[model samples]
Target: MRRTAAALGATIMLSACAWSNAGLPASADETTEDARDSDVILNMFQWSWTSVAEECGSTIGPAGFGYVQVSPPQEEIQGTEWWTSYQPVSYQIEGKMGTREEFAEMVQKCDEAGVGVIADAVINHTTGADTGAGTGTAGSSYALDDFPGIYGPEHFNDCREDISDYTDRDNVQNCRLSSLQDLATGSEEVQDTLAAYMNDLLDMGVEGFRIDAAKHMPAEDLAAIKSKLSDPDVYWVQEVIGAAGEPIQPSEYTGTGDVHEFDYGRQLKSAFGGSIAGLDSIAEGKLDSEDAGVFVDNHDTERNGETLNYKDGDTYTLANDFMLAYDYGRPSVYTGYTFEDFDAGAPGSTATEVGDASCGAEEWTCTQRLPEIQGMVAFHNAVAGTEVTDWWDDGDNNIAFGRGEKGFAALNNTEGEVTNTYRSSLPAGTYCNMAAGTDCTETVTVAEDGSFEAVVPAKGAVAIDVEHME
Candidate 1:
């Protein structure tokens, strides 16, 4: 039997169905687990099924990641562009990523490694009406609103035009997005088909789903579809990019599952670009930490330049390090191929088939596998359930803080090493500096007085946890 742990869980159910990006409000007498109590997620975007299985056993599982969010596995359009995977033709678990049998085996391998798989479920719409007739990665034929043995024009929406008005709920929810045939999600036939497709993946041992383009579909319709799942309580996170003054927002769907907190990344981008001191209030105006799935940069944001990405080099590393150390929403580290063009495909891949992840290859930037990043994962797991305390920042580029008595971290984003005596909540002991790479050669000592003096290197970070001592 497969062992599964959810990276997404909503303890509070909303009383009012209001559409606000603000998260679930806790009751006066309500008590909930610390937002950071859950484990971290590694979004291995575009990684093949076989490659993901190998990575789970080799790196991800050992690093203590609770889950790995994979790209869409259903049969998708046959194109070299990465977005092609987002355009589905059928519900079969056969595509460039792998065959149905291979996907099952990958799930088993990851389960054995204690890593749960969260599949990217692209159920909002199918092949774009403009793509004409073509074959999918698994040889399924699709054209316009026609998917043989799956869906047809009757299953799609009557709103044939593209979405333009955001404030208008009807237009935003019903209209076609980029000419992709929108599913009649409210209809019984479409809902059943979508549920069956998701149930298929769940039966194969996927612990959750990252509902793609969730904002395009009405929250009520999505909730209905989720109710029909084999395990309605299965972990899921919706990709609802929060936009100001938008009628449909992330909060509207928290009753169903967690929603990605876009503000978290945007704030990280701004703070890293300016001063780390500004990050003190990172969660002030966003979703409550527990109901949010936060990331430094995902596939879309990396291309659209909405947040700091792997290209930002040291800055990106420092930002992610801060995210891991901070007590906030569940964190997910993203890794993928390096590309200069927006529509470029993954490395070692083609229009017909996808490639596997090779860590050291110049084309693939396995950011999650970096020594510093991997060490931070251990630091994150060690400090789980702790609160941020002893916060201190230089008003400019340097900051240091502790997570209760479990861990301490200091980061310097400036060009020169910054030395400072920072207060800590950790007990008196020498601990390994987490950001010191794989060897963990550097150590920091927390004195009986609960204070530590250290020199944080420029454009770098240093972290120490009780579980990882020198």
Candidate 2:
């Protein structure tokens, strides 16, 4: 580990210092209790100004999602294109998404609903376009060759013609991403400017940030900007996608916050399709142990045809059911309106002037509001502290497991009907059949032998507990 810099407190800029978690004593029982008590899973996949503000307070607020991940709130070059949001014109909060006041209202509303707001910080670069829309950016005008007094030519690396290899650490960290304008994060001026923009959002009651293009920035520099901000709860979940064996590792950002777990999506895709045994695989430690952020899909992967997002009907529900039933690193649910093209903006899409209600104009509800969805949420909350106790799998498609004594879940992916007998950890009583979708409620009566026989559908899953049992 690198020695702690003496000038760490001197300026708010990043210093080349490494954080070591070695010999940091284990957490106490009470501390774990407090952590479990306060932590709340969120579904903040949508990112427009009005949609974010309204959903932050109302839509996902009451669902007990602890955080709201808003879209990039910074001003971008004016264009009808959706990717324009990713191409930042300036650090200013005003954009087509919504105005500064609307952003504040969203944050306060989420806070009031016991949820935190996370801003998407795009400090990695600027608008890569040459002309026709680059104007009035953070009170400065910009051109292809002459970006006014605010940004200097030295602040940008002229790697336009000479593209650097992303496999190399320096090139990935220092060079431009996909011909986008690369900002010189190592420069003192750039650090201060970016830090001020982030701090402004923090002052508006935003809790943390999702550092976009985090893999393209150095950890030391990110730490420097993080040190400048004065919020104890300022969480950072960087977007560093990783597979089974990748050079660009997720462990690099474990000290910062949680890294996005791309493997989780792969696991869900495989397990739900019956390629991998559901409960047994999860029980036998197929999933990574370290706390990597888990999600079915996100904005980029969903659009790129890489991972399975929740735009579909029953397929999405099965995926989410497994996620809620099994324990994984901090879980995040995605809520979005159906889109015809990948580059399209969010539903009920409106510019910053119209406000959040516009998003609802295109809002479409699928399995997210299903009765089983609510049941899974309650089950996840109920078995928060427990670990997988009794595991059972037929080795092919049928599987079942219990989360200590709190709850039990089973899955059947076989073609025809198959009965499975498993130990019912819950006390003798009638339990609710969660997967039956309210049309038919099957009763699971726990026998004195401490076991229950569940006859599931031709191909389906089931979750039962003492509370909602008929």
Candidate 1 residue lDDT tens string, 309-421: 98999899999999888988878899898999999988867776788889978888888788888889889878877888888888898888888889999999998998888
Q: Candidate 2's residue-wise lDDT over 1-470, tens digit each?
A: 11111221232233323321111001111123222222434544445555565665554555445565777877666555456667765555667666678788877776666667778788888777454345532333456534443455777766653236646676766666777777777776777767767777777777667789877777777777776665523566788765444456767776666667776776676676654365445423332434456777777877786667666455666677677777666666665556668776655444322224344355544334466665666666666656776877777777777877778888766666667677967887777776664333666777776688888655567887655566
**Alpha-carbon error at 241 in model 2, in Å?**
1.7
Candidate 2 Cα misplacement greater than 4 A, ranges: 1-40, 47-59, 129-133, 136-140, 145-150, 161-164, 243-246, 278-290, 348-368, 414-419, 434-443, 455-460, 465-470
Worst 10 residues of 1 by lDDT: 3-12
Q: lDDT for each of the candidates? A: 0.81, 0.62
lDDT of 2 at 168: 65
Cα deviation of 341 in candidate 2 (Å)? 2.0
